[model samples]
Target: METCLCPLTRSFRPDFVLIRQHAFGMAENEDFRHLVIGMQYAGLPSVNSLESIYNFCDKPWVFAQMVTIFKTLGGEKFPLIEQTYYPNHREMVGGRLGL
Candidate 1:
């Protein structure tokens, strides 16, 4: 994502159409909204908010580090994988079993 952004922004001056396409691809999952909200509340600057949040916490930093590494290694080579387990897995299981 970062690699694509660097080149795309350079060529297109951060075109909204292209940015939306890229953003849509990244934000496909429902939980992404949480991350977006968290970042917004973190009070970091817009452009570097992600990096700032990463630097603010160990867990966030680890996540950001993984993403940076993934981006550097090329998103194509290490494509994003959707988790088979849902975030509300335990709740779903409990409801199903009438627990």
Candidate 2:
């Protein structure tokens, strides 16, 4: 935190800030929001701004929005995603999964 503030108070300030904290709850999210707000107050741009982070964390349908954006941005031809659980002896042999 001090490291982030030192540069802000000095003559050189970052043009943009990228906040990549894992905020789980209101308290954590608010903390991150305040950080982003502080950066904006310092006349800087912030990636994943407070509002965006809130929507992303709180909204249940955010993934659908991302999928829409992906398709809109020419990702419609992308392959479908498949998830498989581990410890399946049928798929694993000799400690290696059949890929």
Error of 2 at 63 (Å): 1.5
Compute each candidate's TM-score over C-alphas: 0.22, 0.35
- Candidate 1, 30-88: lDDT as tens digits: 23334545545654345444544334443333455566767788778876542232236
Q: What does candidate 2's lDDT look like per residue over 43-94, in tens digits?
A: 6776767557545554334555655666666545653343333355765454
Candidate 1, residue 70: lDDT? 78
Query: Which 10-residue window in model 1 sums to the lowest lDDT?
Result: 15-24
Q: Residue 47 in candidate 2 has what lDDT?
A: 73
> Candidate 2: worst 10 consecutive residues by lDDT?
78-87
Residue runs of model 2 more than 4 Å from their true location after superposition: 1-16, 23-31, 46-55, 59-61, 70-99
Best by TM-score: 2
